[model samples]
Target: MNPTRHAVSLGLRRGWTEFVLSLRSPQDQGFYLFMGVGTLAYLWFNRDTELEGTGLLLPTFALPSILGALIAFGVVIGPAYALAMEREDGTLLRHKALPHGMQGYVTGQLLYHSLGLLPLLLVILVPSFLLFDDVMSNGAAGWATVAWVLVLGLLATLPLGMIIGSVVPSVQKVGTWGMLPIITLSAISGIFFPIQAMWGWLQAVAQVFPIYWIGLGMRSAFLPDAAVTVELGDSWRTGTTVLVLAAWAVFGMLVTPRVLRRMARRQSGSQVQQAKEAALQWVR
Candidate 1:
């Protein structure tokens, strides 16, 4: 096999390994449980509640939106934290020494993080089916819509995470630079509420980002046709969602490689040492 292909294959295997390890790790399992339970609890409590204008129950409306938020959150923060930590721990430096190692490393990050989303969706989605009715309104077509939207959303947002991770000074900084903004965006992107409830300018701003569109697409997938009454413009705007996500994916595809290349080029023993010292200081 070609050397680069060999590296990518190893990376894919590494990703799968990491995912399996994460599943076995007590801390990670706890996190998954907490998220799944918390989400299900929230939705369960609101199971009987109805949307004001649409007459649809809140859980059915919120489930897909929450799924989108989880996807956006996972793909972004996962890579950011991973890159920053690995950079400090000399993982990137080690990769930098090899032929096409960065390629392999990036492939691993994408695979691991993307696969990481499965348990998150499954834990909630499975219970949701048992607890709620008509949760999937558009039937087969909606599932197809979900597949595309998820692909586009991941393509759109994962690169941003890589970009942020490449630039951030430390893993600690990811909280400030990555987590805060993403969490804030989730709030405004209508994961828990309607975008139409926000100010017009804020709505416009939210629309510019993929999170909003992802949530919108998820809603379109899960909600009945009548639920469109609550969405902005009273439509799913599927075409616009695809366009915006595609644009981000394109931008990321063009820019992330350059950024990663720059970052990789700068990796050296001294920088990795400094990063380690800084991390130790943080621990102290």
Candidate 2:
């Protein structure tokens, strides 16, 4: 087998093993449960409320957007945390010692983070259908849209996480460098309300990021044609969503490897030891 392919295969297996382990871990289980329950509770409480003039139930409008935000949040933050922690613990250095190891490590990360999303999605989506009416208006077509939007969203956002992880000064900095930014984006990205309600420049800033397009693509999937009136330009802008997400994906693909390489080149035993000592001091 080609060396890179063999490395990737190993990475895939490694990722699967990690995912299986995560499923059995109490901490991960608790997180999944918390997110599922919290989201469902929010939707349930708002079940009777309608979106002002749209005549759509709040849950019906909110669910897809929430899912989109989750996708964006999960893929980006999850990898960022993983990479940062692993870097601090010498995992990246260990991988650097092997032939084509970085490739395998990256492959593992991509797969692990991508698969981790399933439990969260199932937790939210399954019960959501059981509890909500008109949850999915377009049926098969809607589902197909869901599939593509998820794929593109993953491609667009996951690299940002990796890049962030590769660049942050330390694992502790991820909050300021990664989490805060994502939270801010979610606020402006129409996950909670219509984007049109925001000031014009805020709307433009929001549209520049993948979170907005991901939410929009998701809304387009589950929402009926009439829901477009509540969206920017009064259309789903499916083409624009794809174009924007693909552009991000391309940018990530071109940039992430270079960033990772630079970060990798700087890793050393002394740096790792210094990180450990810093962590110990912080813990103290």
Candidate 3:
């Protein structure tokens, strides 16, 4: 087998193994439960409320947008934290010593994080259908849209996480460098409210990021045609969503490897030791 392919295969296996382990881990289980329960509770409380004009139930409008936000949040923050912690613990350095190891390592990270979405989605989506009516309006076509949007959203957002991880000085910094920015984006991206309600410039800023497009794409999938009136331009802008997400995916493909390689090159025993010492001190 070609060396890169072999490395990729190994990476895929490693990712799968990690994901399986996470499923069994109590900590991960708690996280899944918390997110699922929290989201369901929010939707449930708002179940009876209707959108001011559309007469659509709040849950019907919110579920898909929440899904999109979660996708962007999970992919981006999960990888960022993983990469940062692994870097501090010498994982990156260990991988750097092997032939085509980085490739495998990256492959593993991508697969692990991507698979992580399933349980999260299932936790929310399964109950959502039971708790809310018309959560999925378009049926088969809606599901098809979901499939494509999810693929594109992952491509677009996962790399940003990796890049943030590769660049942040330490795992602790991920909150400021990665999490805060994404949270800010989510607030402006129409996850909780309509984007059209924001100022014109803020709307433009929100549209520039993948989170907004991801949420928009998701809403397009789960929402009926009439829901478009609540969206910007009073349209789902399906073509624009596709183009924007694809653009981000392309950017990530072109940029993430270079950023990772540069970060990897800088890793050394001394740096790892320093990080460990710093962590110990912080813990103290």
Index of the highest-lDDT prediction: 2
**TM-score result, candidate 3:** 0.99
lDDT tens per residue, model 3, 108-194: 999999999999999999999887889999999999999999999999999999999999999999999999999999999999888
Candidate 1 Cα deviation (angstroms), residue 136: 1.3
Please list the residue runs of candidate 2 whose C-alpha ends up more than 4 Å from where it truly belongs after superposition.
none
Q: Tell me, what's the RMSD of every candidate?
A: 1.1, 0.7, 0.7
Please, what are the lDDT tens digits per residue for candidate 1 over residues 1-284? Answer: 79999999989988899999999999988988998999999999999998897788999899999999999999999999999889888999998998889999999888999899889888889988998898998989999988988899999999999999999988889999999999999999999989888899988889889999999999998888889989888899989999999999999999999999999989999998998888788789
- All candidates in order of TM-score, best leading: 3, 2, 1
**How high is each candidate's TM-score?**
0.97, 0.99, 0.99
Model 1 weakest lDDT span, ten residues long: 274-283
Candidate 3: where are CA atoms >4 Å away?
A: none
lDDT of 3: 0.96
lDDT of each: 0.92, 0.96, 0.96
- State the displacement of the C-alpha of residue 186, model 2, in Å, after optimal TM-score superposition: 0.4
TM-score, structure 2 vs. true:
0.99
